[model samples]
Target: QMATETRTHGDYTVGWICASSIERRAAMAMLDELHEPLPTPEYDRNIYTLGSIGKHNVVIACPPMGTAAPYIISMTNIFRAINFSLLVGVGSGIPPDVRLGDVVVGTLEGHNPKEMMLNPLVEAENSVHVETWAATPPQPLLEALKKIKTEYELSGSRIPEYLERLKRDSPALASRYLKSDSLQDLLFDADYGHVTPDFANLSFIPREENDCRFCDKTMTVKRKPREMRVHYGLIASADREIKSAPLRDRLCRNFGGKVLCIDMDIARIKILFPSHYPCLVVRGICDYADSHKNMEWRDHAAIMAAAYAKDLLHEQDLQILEWLTPVDYGPRHRDFLRRWQPETGLWLLDSAEYKTWLSTKKQTLFCPGDIGSGKTILTSAVINDVKTRFQINPVVGIAYIYCDHRHKETQQIDELIASILKQLTQKLFSLPDCIRQMYEKHKYGQTRPSLNEILGVLHTIIGEYSRVFIIVDALDECPTSSGCRQTFLKELSNLQNQFGVNCFATSRLDPDIIAQFRTNSISLEIRENAKDVQLYVKRYMEQLPAFTELDQWQQETMLVKVLEHVDKRYDLA
Candidate 1:
């Protein structure tokens, strides 16, 4: 039940910027779920495919062949919540350590031809100082790189499995994506030229059809055959594509022979975007950056790059889940939700008031009932439903608090609000710098954040999301003697008024709690919920020993009696 139709620009977090149609197809093939196309601004020229890979909702797009600069900036604007950008495609591989179909993850260095001093660069061993623009992948991507390398070292890369899935899912594109045996990956000597024998005529035509068929085999560099591997290092970026072996080798030499690949897109992106814009360039080596370049390995290289990017994203999702937080209501929510009968909450889920709360902003749904009336259980169901519906979109934050009188000492106003902040912040790609700074400031002082400090962080963090749902279960259980409950309710009200955060709460029909929500929320009293009570009684009876062994009349009599007793107080648990 993916609600693709209702998705907006903010729903997407990962921007997969491709250079060619093959790369776009390869990216699409790697997606676990393909989302419907979202409407774009009329001025946006780039076409897009919305999809999901692991936990990330990715928006894949290919800029018009030679015009990537404008479209990439447009992509940044269009996908407003994009924290991670992946420049995925095929590029010319440098010699020695790189080969066709090998993937290159970039710690990109943007170079300008004018700024590079090539006059003294001819001393083959000497490193030349060039004024270059450099950008590293964000912290999360770098962490993912480390994790993936370790995993690959232990059990090998997942590329083969992903390729198999591609073959099974898209039969038509399988042959194209798969490596061809006939496409021999040849590396020529740096001095070898692909020009014909008539050297003085200045006719710049290749001797072979973009291959080394007519070239001397004795000049070829023999390499060992091995499985495709990922190489991480400096990737040089310039204004134009690299086609000459001498220039390619010189660029590599200038960088102390650390550049693994060369591409034309990365430089433009670095110049067009902000200095700190986080992006990782993944290039599959389609050809050696020499005279003999061809399209033979382009498809295979694109697929390899896409596969590596997908694996990195999966690792990133795992890292996000492991983010340390001060408070976690997940265990409490899970405990309560375990008692939920599958179809018992249909009445609330299908009700007009609940649907309205989900669709409208700054809305609240208050479920108040007597003690043991199943308010907490119904609250769990609502929390589960909200999570399921909005899980794919990272910008849609969902946080829940399960308050208990037993833990009133620990569940103070600040603690409850901090938990909400923790949940929402975890949904982001990285913690907001402001939140990080606040934590550091308090951490150094060895003091806890005051209620105002926590609320301030909460306000800032909530602004990062396009929408937020805050569910507080058993609100009446919060201590009222110290005005903790009042303060908590006021903060929720402020968040709702200022940020349009949706608020959902369940509690006993205490006069104070009822008065707080009476004017602003849609009230749903949980008492004598006949269908839920009947469903629970039937399920409980089925688990009993003699209930199923009895006749229909006896069963009916037992069921009626149980329902009658339970109907007075519908806790069901």
Candidate 2:
């Protein structure tokens, strides 16, 4: 039997799904006040407890215990009715460094359920299947977790206060399960096991009054406060308990040593929910999932997880989804930039012409250089400088493309335009109306825009910004045989002519590319500095072991030869 009245989806944006009664109770304890339970249909067996936490209507539920199937069913229905902005709950943890009540936040590497699964053949051979689920939580939730972690580290007493409050609320449960002293939190070697004696022999009976005496406290490992603090990494999720220490270590190693903890339920939630749904898993370490299982840390761990969740929800605006759709282009640009240090292009930064180009509008700078004359580094330096110069201006936008022959796909014209658009929109913090409309039209179908469509979008986005600067490096690396290189350069020229956009480009003196920009663009040839080259050759000759053993005349001859070769190469370029 179920109540006739149903709970409206608009009333609640956060859905907290707990695996056990203790976890559900822990979540409820964090709420400010409880609301009336809405009616559920007979077919829907979930028991929903509606509540409010800091102006947010939260619905908490605990599916039937002991199996994952019922929990999946409950979550499926819950998500269908409520578009949860936050989906999280307490889960079991299995990391040696993670203490009994410490929290572990999931990173991007930890959200792959497919990689965590055991192959059918391996499962058949072992007579068991390991469950590993991983999904990256939303960006906002991750940011909130980072803030809460900082506060916890600084205060050092929040967990104790939260425990005290829980004790006052439920005295009996606290006494039974949360009464262990800090010294009781011990770590045993993975190979160690509880001793089992022969029951058939009467001599095996213990003489002392204490419970079986096989446990050794001296074998425990010691840890510092920082070691027990909150951790952020990949979390392995599965339905069955991982009790073998060797297996746990193997899984951790197999996952590239990034798995900070293991959980039971997060994988199912990720597998069932839509990919766009915003969710985060915040779990406390209840057990090590080894031979040392106990009820002492269960209540305290649940409380800590719920307390952290409450802190995360506080003062957070639940209505905004600004951070939900993350842009991928930023990371790609950053990865390329990280290889070179800040001063790699110091020579280019010191140039007076480059300074003039930075302040000029509707100007095109074609920086032509030799293959190894450090053009790419100069382009990166120019991009960094432009970003710093216009960081405070909302009307200015900066975009860049680093072309490499090693990666052919990145040189595609559509990819180039898409990358530029992504950078501009990310800087603006919102997409232009035209780009948003195009995205909406194709997002559901997983269809990418054609080159012409992307060019139209880029044109619209450029018009939105008062001044836009585009830097394209290594134009010679783009596949000229496919005509993509020519087409892309033509678009840049068009942008400068039509929208008055400034273009900074680098190439290896390609005849076709030079012809396109030579008329109106400023051409700068990157030549090697003779004095710097001589200094480098001298340093190299001094460092060589053989040259150090040689006479002064021999060392001088080697330096002269190196300088002559460098001069010849520069002249050929």
Candidate 3:
């Protein structure tokens, strides 16, 4: 009974998801036999069209218009029952070579699937795979495409016959396609856009017919042969429409000229499918994805995409479903200090000695104080000051680490080094070749670097930047079980002494830790800056209504008492 149920659910061989109603209708028109709409669960909002195309049982679906999240949810729920998926839709073309009616088929490239599965805009330990999350079409689909191209070359294209069949089934779709004008398929130079005061305004307003102000023939680019063609390359998928030619060109170039078109929804679906579940995008070229996008060719483009999908599906044999188990790269961890770093409240910013050290050639500056002397706050202020001073210099990189006793697992020496390295590489926007090579070597396996291996990567990364500022706060809190603290300090000393990386660290004055920095480091005592504490205390107390209600003499007495208690604590340390 279980085997029969599994076989019934696995009968769906192809899944088709479209972005618009026109694309969905075009896809439905290609079906050989149609069935009644299958009942779905309440949570499943997708309106699925069940049918057979050629010898394959295909499921066609579309989400509510103008959103992508529901499409993702719908596809994921249906993907388990199907063997393969196709994101068939209309996308904007990157112009000059790609024309208005051209079809773009996405090809796969190697990508870190773990990074692509997560939201790219959110913060994560590993960098997001923004431009590299595409995979080539599977081997079977590529062979079918080649056969289709060869057939089209031998005989006339099948698109005309497909259009006739579609006309008989739904005249409305055929009428829309017939009304699509080829004269509106004009390619303009990248530098010339709609003549507006600012090109950033994206709202579309109704205009009278023949009122286009920027339709000068001088700005139009003429193509030699305006024939429809199939282009195989990277098809970028994003949640929003790309509207600038400069940005489109930049993305195309960044993807190494393999990106031929841009779509609103496809890449996200591709990344979430099972690794063995073959997927491809068949999209018609609607517009140039620039500022001048109009709805002149959308219907015609959708028809072209559906026609191409039918040609690819016709006469294909049923495939046996073989599930390939995907490799799981573990979750990426982040060492984020910006949210937890101490506030810079009336301290460190006014320190003349620290300012002098920052402006000069000092390689290391140590701020030692008792546990409650606001060392973390001081370190945070120094970080802010350095960032402000170096705001204009693109070559300077700044990173900080805050050690906590509560999180014992992260306090190890290797974790500390990895956190620091992650911060620096993220800030610099490019990793050193040495670190990249090391990562590539260990990427396939679960083996992480030893302490020595991490140190070697750090040493090489430090040489790539002109200057790097690293701040380590609460070093005394680092675990001391296996000489972790000593090893961490020794590595810092080496970075300062050998590589000239400017290191700023704050800790309680332990003789062992201080001794490590005594020879080449400049130490500043927080107790010496009593004025900063006084100012901080006064400002903090002024905000309290009860303290404000006290008499002047009472305020002074309370202030003195607070300072004396703090001083005694420092003495104990």
- For residues 1-573, write the lDDT of model 1, one tens digit per residue: 143456778989899999878899999888877887888889888979998876678999887654567788888888999988888998889888898999998764344222364443246434333333445567877888888888688547657757765675678899888887877888889889764345523456543344566689788898889888899777776665556688788887777777788777766776677657777888999988777787778889999999899888877654433332445676677777888888897888999999999999999999988888888888889988998798656568999988888987768887788778877865654345566566567666666767788788788889888899999888888888678888889889999999999999988888878998879789988775778878888988898998999998999998998876764555644
Instruction: Itemize residue pairs with steric clashes in candidate 2.
Output: 111-134, 111-135
Give per-residue CA lDDT, model 2, range 172-231, as digits (tens): 756643545642565667777544355522565543222214567666666664434566
Backbone clashes in each candidate structure, one number apiece?
Answer: 0, 2, 4
Q: Output the number of the TM-score-best candidate.
A: 1
Model 3 C-alpha RMSD vs. true structure (Å) is 22.1
The whole-model C-alpha lDDT of candidate 1 against the native structure comes to: 0.79
- Ten contiguous residues with the weakest lDDT in model 2: 318-327
Worst 10 residues of 3 by lDDT: 321-330
Residue 292 of candidate 3: its Cα lDDT? 70
So what's the TM-score on candidate 2? 0.47
lDDT of candidate 1 at residue 477, scale 0 to 100: 86
Q: RMSD for all candidates, in order, please.
A: 16.7, 14.8, 22.1
Candidate 3, residues 293-328, lDDT tens digits: the string is 777777788878887887777624211100010111
TM-scores of all candidate predictions against the true structure: 0.52, 0.47, 0.47
Top candidate (lDDT):
1
Model 3, residue 186: C-alpha shift (Å): 0.8
Off by over 4 Å in 1: 1-5, 108-134, 195-209, 320-573
